[model samples]
Target chain A: MDATERPVADLPAQRDGQEVIHLDRVEKVFEVRRRAGLLRREKREVRAVDGLSFSVGRGEVVGFVGPNGAGKSTTIKMLTGILTPSAGTLRVAGVEPARDRARLARRIGVVFGQRTTLWWDLPLLDSYQLIHRMYRVPDARYRENLDRCVELLGLGDLLDVPVRQLSLGQRMRGDIAAALLHDPEVLYLDEPTIGLDVVSKANVRHFLADLNAERGTTVLLTTHDLTDIEQLCRRVMVIDHGRLMYDGEVAGLHRIAEVERTLVVDLATEMAPIALESARTVKVEGPRQWLAFPAGQPAAPIVAEIAAGWPLVDLSLREPDIEDVISLMYAGRSAG
Target chain B: MAHGPGRAALYAAVAAKGFRRYATYRAATLAGIFTNTVFGVILAQTYLALWAERPGLGGYDQAQALTFVWIGQSLHMAVAAMGGGSEEELMERIRSGDIAVDLYRPVDLQLWWLAQDAGRACFQLFARGALPLAFGALVFDLALPASPGTWIAFLTAVALGLLVSFGIRYLVALSAFWLLDGAGVGQLAWLVGMFFSGMMLPLNVFPGLLGEVARVLPWSSILQLPADVLLGVHTGTGLLGVYAFQLAWAAALLAAGRALQSLATRRVVVQGG
Candidate 1:
């Protein structure tokens, strides 16, 4: 059949509570040789991803978060069929990724933030044109998608520029647009905000949120930037030492980690650190004092205790940052 | 988008992109032209000096010998450049983990790269092949093919030569999948290719047994056969035999490349960051 003869359906209807991505105890072990002593070598098995099992429902925007070398990238690679799991079952959109990689490629979009998928020497438009042919995107659909991406990503003025010349932020936006030109049902973004400025990060986050909400594109995002998760992912999974440490809502992570929320109290006059039973003062600056209490604890009682004991001119409670929560979780895991 | 361009169109696009990529390196192309031209001059002079003493050596007169020199020079970039160091590019991509992205695409990795090399060879055939031959013809008394048939046969032999060369390079690059570093293998292949393929000197000049062995090897199909056909060294049935040898090697090596590529993909270990 001719390429143009294909139907123009947008997306397959999501089955009720059906998982788009499913992994059952998948494991990936890499055999690496390391220098032992003079001219000797040691063969070691590095279990990059060990016994991981998770399911992402249709249209769910999930964040896969971890510290460096925590198997996050490994998982993404497996999902894209770039790496095959050593053991266990893995499926994406009802297809085994490694076995049906070529077919899976048509249904998924991927972006790796550290390196570009664009042709460095070609203009952005040319890269898109090549991708159009590579993915076999229909002519009319290609134009429509390009127009939408160009306008929405603010890529109109930059389309003629070579990808090598674009700033990190602009190039990243261009990469995102390139991935989506084929209208994939699932988008896998690995560190999509790694090296962007604040404004660019916000822009990427906003675009991703809109993409997930409006298009119902299932997004699996791997990022070091916690703000990316806070803004985009309602469901976040934390992995460390090749194990899932936590998987739930973003707010629920603070409770799992036993993280502390900070309360900064400003006194009318400079005084010694206020003594409060409800909360411990972690830092004291002339007229201002910082207190730490369990994030799960009510801040009202602590505020009342401080007000009763000292001259509480102004006070505010700051929720725990995701970074702090994750580190605390890691620390607790190691200690235990 | 529901459907994309067909496989043939996608391969063509990759080839065109490769052509544009190499075309942008104007300085390198000029330098390559200069280097090939200089080598052609030196080779022509060497052949002239040798012919002055012997008058006719290895059944080639001075003019025919000079023509061989120029043809060898013109085809050098088309064959050697296309054959050389693509292994390094593949190894670099593997080390940088960019191979992951490449594997994720729907295209077959071997065919995609083959198309890219085809584009590069097409450009070099013009920029590096024709210009040097024109320069040699202008400066020296170069012999031309006697008939249209010889020209057509020579062109067909050259095309086969390119396919054989690409096959060899593809195998060398595929080594990176297992060896992790293809430099050593690539260097070794280059040495064997240069000597046996008659890029440096005609295989006919090699001592009796060595020349016979070179004729049977696939590398000879890459340069020597084409050069012989271009200079009208082989005629009639002998010429057909030469074409058959080239086609056989091209087919064999390309099959080997594809088989190796399949094995390599199964055990792809994308290294580093």
Candidate 2:
């Protein structure tokens, strides 16, 4: 039977511990009015999330990726009950999110990397205390969760500092802690590592992995960072144009997408493109050349060849990011 | 799981957090007090001139008119009578899609904001309000209510007025859901609030239809009714009537805000990811 043909009332019976999030042909259409000229206005419907269907199980960490305007955020908003779907049905933790948002809120925690949820003027701990009461977490349970988050997120010294005074990474950690004080069953993170330095990114990834391992918290993460997907998500879902493009193992994504690693070399002198068997120079500038090689292969040999044969001053390897992989998928789709 | 007492405590904590959030702006608070005082002096002098021109104008003697000026200044920030302070943050949050975080919270959005606004009102009542009124009293002779009962009644009126003000402002802030930019609505709200809340001129002083309409509008509850209660212009049943008026408007406006919020959440198009 087709997902669209399924009866709306025929929702799967409560399987709380198994499938924590379920969506069937979920669609979100936004009617936007644009001023055509001085007095005339034109209205158009943009189907932000068009007939999207997917689910996440308990203890599974899934990477949700899409290019800009790809409906990833729209789908998350529908799942979180922030935006009612124009069509289809969505359920999280056995509750219809839009119909029962406040109830569902107790079961899920969400963090937006671009913006903070913590009170900017208050101490980080004050915001946590407010969250404690707002969620009505039991005193003892709240303490336990708070202690765990504080310890793991390195929020000990940052608790007393005002959120406005903290760095972006510090504020993000504080936000993550606030979201977890209630021990939510599922976590939706949108670009949780957007602007963090290497150490902070590693710290967040480690903490999230531990969160899934210890508590079985269902994690649905959307990001532009592929390393986050490689390290944290065993299963990755790729959506574009408001539709799911691919959903499978991360390794499978790389196989199908066929990513390339770039070796950017700066030669001591401006020269013709380096002659190498393993890599091909994609672009060349004064004293600089970019070589593209199969990502599956190592970069050491290519670097050694350049260093030994040519006047190589410095070189750095650039991993293909999510955009590259997504464009590759798009190109392959068009060709095939 | 958190029943009656726990829920009430949670709201109180929210209010407390709101209080602390504003308290951090010590410099802003000081600057606000100075501005209120300066405006108070200018308005009082003008009122003095008008009262001198026509004695007992709008049922207020020269002293009573001066009292009105100072009281209006005091309640201005406390009630957010002109409608654009902390609610700007809510507008910005809505525009930037950060309101998604707010909706994710388990608490009722209306009540959470109401509690926080109440906290802001309480903080401003003292920090920006009391000092200006005190300065006004030092500079000029103003009408004084002799009884503690009168003071209590006035404070109760002020609290009710705060609710009405918050209801209007929250509605304006929630407009961002549809407008995607609330600055225009915010400016309109400020204009309506300033004109009808008796911040510009006392509702009593207006002539005929304008006075009658201004006196009954919800904005009147923010300043006019409260000021009247404090000035002993309303006594006995009149006092109860003023309270009832403020209560009705507050209920209606807040319920409207609540309805609009639910409607907005159903159709919300957050600006960005």
Candidate 3:
């Protein structure tokens, strides 16, 4: 077999902790047919993923972040072998996902937040049993995995309930358990916390954190919630318009986006907008003003400037939120 | 390192799961049995009226005609496995993008669905099939297959008929992979299947060349050939030929279904959930 189609066991040993997931210049173009006018139709090509390339080493948790329709879901689908790339090569655990999907399926788990993989009408335990058989998981291993997941994910009481009856959070946990029952080496979670309440979100986040830390399972997380990235991933990749916009440490994203920190100052009495060289007053109220300064610039200087110029009664510095950083990144790309 | 159950175990599990899934719909099963039994009585009365008018219509005596009506009703669920709509379950999965998850599984999609259908068929055979046939036997003087060999041959023919029916349904569902909205195509398939499969009327009832044409088509193997074997209309060598023809259609349709599925997978565009 070609290197791309090699069996997982035949993978060359890791010299420097080998890459478990690899993509080289992958592209996906969708042909959409639309009605042009009465009795006429037009064909359009949408480039869902454009020449994307990235790699993840074993046991690394990487956050894939982007705006809606930024090709995040498409990329994940390609990785999971649900969609074949129009061009380029992709290997997961040394197997071409599309060409050897069944083989690769044994080594990877996937959960789409908007969909449940469990049988809708079956009880949670029944769905797990079906998954056990579908994947051919051995009885001993199956029971072990089920017990572990149920214990760790708080699925004990929910096992008897049908998946349709479970709350979204409960169902999501069930899906996660189902995906992992086969002991896949890698996991792909797309918006795993979407629409979840605060408590459920925390439970999911905590479970994922423990899973990654304990098993060292490679994880690729795609989510809109910045807190999910902040808590789970140290490395993050930003994609926009089907291109990799940034790939670096999570904290480094703020500097790359060129977003600014905000300084909110409440003056003692009604006053003019605070004027300073280090920062600019972006908004002004009768007794309050908001200043914006480069995120990378020292916040101490901007705060000092604001205090000296205005009758500042209370002042606070707001770090650049991840949401602003990402938006700024997208805005910068569009403008340039 | 390989993990999980072997392929045989996985397939059996899928079939068993499919069976269990349908078994849970006790209410729907009861309703379906009721509808089929009611339809069987009406059709039997119509046949009796036809017999009164001609004594021996389309080569069927009164006893054989009554047997045909009841057996046809019992076999309705078994042969029309699509259950009125053409592969609606599979089509819904394809349209709703749930098929993507299915594609990711290690099992072959067509085979998996077929196994699931087998489970549903088993449930239907016991729940819907037995009752209608028993009800007909109670309410009407139904003729039984003359010998044990005939009973065995009839059962074999019915099994093959189920396989062929599943193949056709699977192929129709695969059309959703390309057409996206295959409801119209599905409707056309059911219409054609019902007319030619002798579900509407026995193929022998068709006049001259039209009857010959209906018998030659694959649809007759789905119901008429099996029913004919059961009624002792074809025996010994002729019965063997019927079995062979049913097997051939089952194999051909399943092969065509598999080929179509392969092509469809290449072009699968799973839409939004």
Output the number of the lDDT-best candidate.
2
Docking class of 1: acceptable
The residue-level lDDT of candidate 1 at B102 comes to 83
Model 3 per-residue lDDT at B50: 87
lDDT value, residue A301 of candidate 3: 71
Worst 10 residues of 2 chain B by lDDT: B78-87
Q: lDDT (CA) for every model shown?
A: 0.82, 0.86, 0.82
lDDT of 3 by residue, A10-111 (tens): 223431357989999999999988999998999999998999998887777788988788899889888888788999999999999888878888889999
Candidate 2 ranges with C-alpha deviation above 4 Å: A1-17, A35-40, A260-319, B1-3
How would you order the candidates by DockQ, starting with the best?
2, 1, 3
Tell me, by TM-score, which candidate is best: 2
DockQ of 3: 0.36
**Candidate 1 Cα errors over 4 Å, as ranges:** A1-16, A37-40, A257-324, A333-336, B1-5, B81-87
- The residue-by-residue lDDT of candidate 1 on B90-142, one tens digit each, is 66776677888888887788777888777777788888889999999999998
Runs in model 3 deviating more than 4 A are A1-16, A256-325, A332-336, B1-5, B81-86, B146-148
Model 1 residue A94 lDDT?
86
Write down the C-alpha DockQ for each prediction: 0.37, 0.65, 0.36
Q: Which ten contiguous residues of candidate 3 chain A have the minimum total lDDT?
A: A1-10
Two-chain DockQ for model 1: 0.37
lDDT tens digits by residue: candidate 2, A52-136: 8887776678899988889999898888888889999898989999888889999999999998889888888888888888888
